[model samples]
Target chain A: MQKSLLIDPGKCTGCLQCELACSYDNEGVFNPAKSRIKVFNFHDQGRFVPYTCTQCDEAWCLHACPVEAITVDRASGAKVVADDICVGCKVCTIACPFGTVNYNQSTGKVMKCDLCGGDPECAKACPTGAITYVDADWTGLERMRTWAAKTDAGQRATA
Target chain B: MKYVIAGAGPAGVIAAETLRKADPEGSVLMIGDEPEPPYARMAIPYLLAGDIGEKGTYLRKSKNHYKDLRIDYLQDRVKKVSAKQREIVLDGGGRRAFDALLIATGATPIKPRVPGLDLPGVHHCWTLADARAIAKRAKKGADVVLMGAGFIGCIILESLLSRGVTLTVVEMAERMVPRMMNDKAAAMLKRWCAAKGVAVKTGTKVTKIEKSGRGLTVHLDRGKPVAASLVVVAAGVKSNVGFLDGSGVKVKQGVVVDDRLQSSAPGIFAAGDVAEGPDFSGGWSVHAIQPTAADHGRIAALNMAGHPARYKGSLAMNVLDTAGLISASFGRWDGVKGGDFAEAADKAAYRYIRLAFDGDRLIGALALGLTDHVGVIRGLIQTGVALGDWKQKLMSDPHRVMDAYLARAYA
Candidate 1:
């Protein structure tokens, strides 16, 4: 079965380990600025939210790409930007509604989450279990279980 | 089924691929006049700017992409279409019969009515061949005079500047990108370009070009003639529907296609810049942008493959980065008839926002120096979600568009 990265922002510790791992694996660097995944610190909410490409079914970046450089990695179901094919026109950068695809000035090509070809580095490097590689079809299983436990009569009586 | 696609640009290429996926047994033929493989015209500026190589402009890197897919490729221009005959005549004096025909011929650069445009140093920077010619002459410190500062011209400004050329922009419009931006926003963009060391002359027209010493002199209607080693014309483009003159296809500013992208003639369809398809703001318009082209390709291809798909409409949006300043306009940015608009501008900070609303739905937006979370503006307009009370909140604080989008769109 295909796997996808499921992120739970509440468990994120703002450590940016996922960013470091992403950059190191994909970019061969430890710079968070070069990472595919980003940990946003909400100072007002005092929360850390790790975000990256959600790999939408009808990806705007994939369609907006005039050169067809962005393609789906069938193994991970992730839309990956082929560096060799990309021409760095920055069309996909604006096309992505989530603002995940970014232009790399140093390389003159666009970069986005590739899901590490299959084994995502961000999922493995998450210290707080905030990001996990789970079955794509059942991403909301945990959230449903949490709500289901709250609705359970026995649990309500014990509380 | 025999499928023939005119213009092997992005739209044609994607449509062909999508058709191949759905109809594996159908015969696909794509025709383009260019010598090279199908390439993105949008990437030509990057090639001119030295950001990417010539090979990088191709739509697909693999040389056998089309070949492997069994899609026949032809390097011949389409001369005319005989819709009644279900065939198209090629410039090479060849004719091909088609069960279905897609007119994705895109647009051609509009040549300004001026003399000496045929001179060696003068060119239209619209095609890859044009980029190559411009690159050779637009060397460091070369005196280059660019005519027009419209959307197409502005896109090439930074690329021209990146070559270290002494550039001067002459526009007939009142300001830069007049069609896409309001007077205030256009004025701000002009200032930003001027600060980037570009000589911008708005409300000016190039009257003539005369040969000079290893260069040329461009005569303007308002100012003194400027000396230039090269003259690059970015005036505008007209839809490439010349072949459709007697093909029974309805024509406006572009080929008039219906909600299904089919033309007046049966079995004939249009897409990309050539097709004046449905508009998001409630009409038909030719949104010549790349996103619209791609969208049209997929939707038209699905219909061609016997999958009925209704195109909602193409949104008219443009996000431009002039030098370093980012400016964007979406939908009816100038505000519709009897529509309400809220605006805020910090001229000193080079930041501006103008949100237009029709009733309770956000319809359009104009933004400058607000790149972060700008996509939300598109989301709000495209979704057409009723803002209700949040409309008032957005009017008071235009910067809270992201918050408004999340709340309203999800709610």
Candidate 2:
């Protein structure tokens, strides 16, 4: 069963716990600038969306890494950046369409979600369950259920 | 059950401690993204002003106190979570299965996408790193340009001014702390800032921030370029919910949770700055203060542990320290439209009080400098005391308001 994150934007209060968890997991500091997962706040719309590297089956960040620093973790299916191998060229950061991968000035290394080997701290720290770890293959199950519930099935004729 | 808490901010650490207290036999694990344990983000301004030292800002429960509680304090962040498998993946390819999970990820400072915002001397005051950066450049005679005159900006200005740093505040709004203070209170604060030699420019926008030699030049909308050795951007913060893209947890402005702080998913919960819970005073409002965040952590942890606790909403009380002056505001100040507006001001004493109302019910108030009757006004607001004959006594002696209310409530 592949594990995947389920995000509910309505539950997100723009808290950076996930970022802090990501940063502390990777950078050893509570620096959001260094976190792989970044929360975007649309103030006018009153929305908080946590965006990160989705670990796409065919990852752009991995292909863009000239040094081959980005690699997929077999066990967790996470695309991770190997800091020692990374050249800090920032080519991959631009290559990614989603802008999930970023360059950290202090470390001069590119950073993105590594999925914490599979047990995501952001999911653990989330008080509202806005972020959840679930079966990766069934990520759309919740949405499917919602739409299924909305399906207008007229009441069956009385038995 | 071994509990793993992520993020060492107030929400994370408080949850860890609460878990220890609730289930003494349960093992606790705290993972901090920052090198330092949770320090008071609220006290950073005092540290910048030299009133408090680096040690004073520490909000930790003593060194290795988690060890005493038999809590495994992991410095690493959890990279992945497998809810079906009941395990968490660590950064270095490690996994830890947990009986329950609590996410207390706090909010991060919003760094706008303005050009040159990432340049040196540009900083935000949400973390120790930001504080240290600003403090390093805030020399004895350095000129500092602060963007955003909200709570953080005003507090940082007060701290910087004490160190003899020339300060200029640039706010896009018409008044300072406009969200928290009404027009009347804002006017009083503006005058106070002016009297203290702080240059406050409201309704002004920062067009560009460019590097000039060792210093930086901040170009304003209708003024000559203001050069500063340092610049602090206290614009505001947004929830740190960016990692939930593929995660099936529902989110809006914040991680939307019901009164129980439970999200759409099972075995997962969010609190602190990340989770938006029910607001009793208003309809489903999210509060981003430290006290409220602490409350969220406690309530969420209990529910996660099967105690079935519901979070009662928190009051949005913003107490500010502007130089030596203290300003505290609570509830809705705008509710008081037009019943009576009364004030007592002394420029020399720096003392001021302005009260507004709608007939009998107390609506809004501003207390500045030093007033002996602040407690009375605060109590009246808290208890929802109708003015009755109290309005007449308030005009002559405001302290009588509290005395009368206390007499009635206790009577």
Candidate 3:
């Protein structure tokens, strides 16, 4: 079954462990600054939203790459940067609507989350279950069940 | 041919790549002082934001990026250059010869001569080592006092805030980013940051930093002393032009270069922050932005490769995302002498646009919370396109820039 990282921003504690884990897994270093998955803190609102490349089927970064540096991972459905091929032009960083495909100045290549070769370190590192790897088809199963339960209560009250 | 590039910053790296591309048989030696793998200083802010790791800051990712290209990368400081002999002496008593030399030494963060600056808690967020040190002490709920609210300082505020530190920003200027922005635009930015719970002290200076008990105390020019665990000095930067002294390379605020980026010495070129080349406004100024540096690298490499490439003066442009507010400035953002100005501000939407005009040409612009017209503004200014009748319309309604641009260019 295909897997997806389902994120619940409400459950995030802003600890940045997911970022550190993702960076470490991909880069072999404990640097959250280089992490593909980023946690944006809305401090005034007291909200933390961890964002990353959503691995769109028709990725903007893939198409925007002039040298075809960005590619799709067939197995994980992730968009990855072929650093060797990237010319460091930064067109993909502009093409990405979500601002997920960002340019790495050090490497002169654009980078996004590749889901850590399908295991997805961000989901595993989340302490509060804010991020979870689940079956892509059944990601909304819990939400549907909640609405169904609400409908049943409404019908019971009407009866 | 032996090509030596003194400085492995972005421009230097690009120069090496370009040189290698054009002259496949030539030997390229890229030298930098920093011991770490060639990295972008701009990425440090992202590092502070916990966006990527140290490896993410590297200019080339794949193993053997430079090695595969056959470019020699060295991490040795240059003490001086014998420009007359086309030789560079390393600090460790070594000499390297060059047929073509490009100086992309970049800049160094200025450590202001302030009392108690040598203390343990005070740090300059410039290098990888500095980032690690800052990450250690700038813990969640830690009191952090950041000196200087300029472009560099303000850029890192978001990252520091993300790290969950209690931030207090002190700026010597009346407003933030004084070099790039006007009072109104800077004021708007400061208000936006303050509204988001950031403590902004404008036109303020840090008199001294003293150790108070186990923590530290930051004395300000005005108001009460700020208690802090971490004090980040984000004051300013100066060009890396020291190695060229007595080399007859010529120096102003930076190494002086011509339109070809060629210095006084034959076969010597300067690029990036170290080179004070021509500015768009008829004078020489160092545009330290990344895009300009990339252009410099390309042009310098082309010239070195025996291709004639003339650099038409660099333009000053900066786009900043402070907290949630996005702001940008381009060209002579502060209107020139006797230049007409058109401005529009929407306090409710937090949208603003100010257009600078010299005669009929679009000279410069300031924008806040408006990203759609950025490209058009840049294009019109760079081209020096005459607005004609559309100029009057823009003067009345700056939001009609798209329409004016369409009418002028296409219509």
Query: What interface RMSD does each of the candidate structures achieve?
Result: 13.2, 24.9, 22.4
Question: Residue B372 in model 1: shift from native, Å?
Answer: 3.1
DockQ (CA atoms), all models: 0.19, 0.01, 0.02
**Native-referenced TM-scores of chain A, all candidate models:** 0.86, 0.84, 0.83
Task: Write one digit per residue (lDDT tens) for candidate 2, span A11-119.
Answer: 9898789889888888899978777776766555676777665675535456434334677899889998887666444445433434466666566466778889899
Across B197-282, the per-residue lDDT of candidate 2 in tens digits comes to: 88899999888999999889999888888999888888888887675655566778677887667776676777777887776346
The regions of model 2 sitting more than 4 angstroms off are: A1-159, B78-95, B336-365, B370-401
Lowest summed lDDT window (length 10), candidate 1 chain B: B402-411
Residue B197 in candidate 2, Cα distance off native in Å: 1.8
Q: Write the per-residue lDDT of candidate 3 for residues B309-399, one digit (tens) a residue.
A: 7777777777666775767777887888999999999876778889999998888888888754354565567557689988998999887
Candidate 3's TM-score: 0.74
lDDT of 1 at B40: 91
Candidate 2 DockQ category?
A: incorrect
Error (Å) of candidate 2 at residue B47 is 1.6
How does model 3 fare in lDDT? Answer: 0.78
- Residue B328's lDDT within candidate 1 is 81
True contacts kept of each: 0.29, 0.00, 0.00
